[model samples]
Target: MTRRIEQGVERGSRITIFVDGAPVAAFAGETLATALIASGRIAFRRDGRAALRGLFCNMGTCSECFVQTAVPGRAPRRLRACLTPVADGMAIETGAGPDG
Candidate 1:
């Protein structure tokens, strides 16, 4: 299970983001990877070879944390979970499926 840093630090406003139809609690200004990791979802996607991929180079140089996201009326798009900030109502899918 993924765990959050217990620094006893105050966080920004909390928001809900959907991951594979399940709701995950996230704080504003935090990256999707951070939220996922805190929520015990370490694997962001699976490669063509079926290898699980998660955060690697967090500075966007590597695309290991890519995830598919979709909003109402808009086509699904891919973004790096480590670089993309979490937004309220964001829908994400993680895996080597048609959506991701």
Candidate 2:
């Protein structure tokens, strides 16, 4: 199920979470923030200085939209929530800055 956002596929459905070594259910078609917020898992990211940040802008351009995804055959990578479409079993990690 997708929300009508001016001809854009912007919504998701119920899904799951992989954070801090645990699995949680997340809403499909929902942004990571939307799902996390619904599940009260809102510490979306940590800044370079280790400051916590959540979905501030809710758009693809913000650094706060970062999420780590478990891509098959490739190393895990950071994806922007505002731009990525959520999958049924997508694994996401929250509140960690990129490794230096």
Best by lDDT: 1
RMSD of each: 3.1, 6.7
- Candidate 2: tens digits of C-alpha lDDT, residues 1-100: 4232437555455466665446766666666666656555667777788877777777777677687776567787887766675566677777554431
lDDT of 2 at 82: 69
How does residue 61 of candidate 2 score in lDDT? Answer: 70
Residue pairs with colliding backbones in model 1 are: none
Per-candidate TM-scores read 0.84, 0.66
Per-residue CA lDDT of candidate 1, range 27-98, in tens?
999999899889877788888988888888888989989998867778778899988999999898886454
lDDT of 2 at 24: 63
lDDT of 1: 0.85
**Candidate 2 segments exceeding 4 Å error:** 1-14, 71-73, 96-100
Full-model lDDT for every candidate? 0.85, 0.64
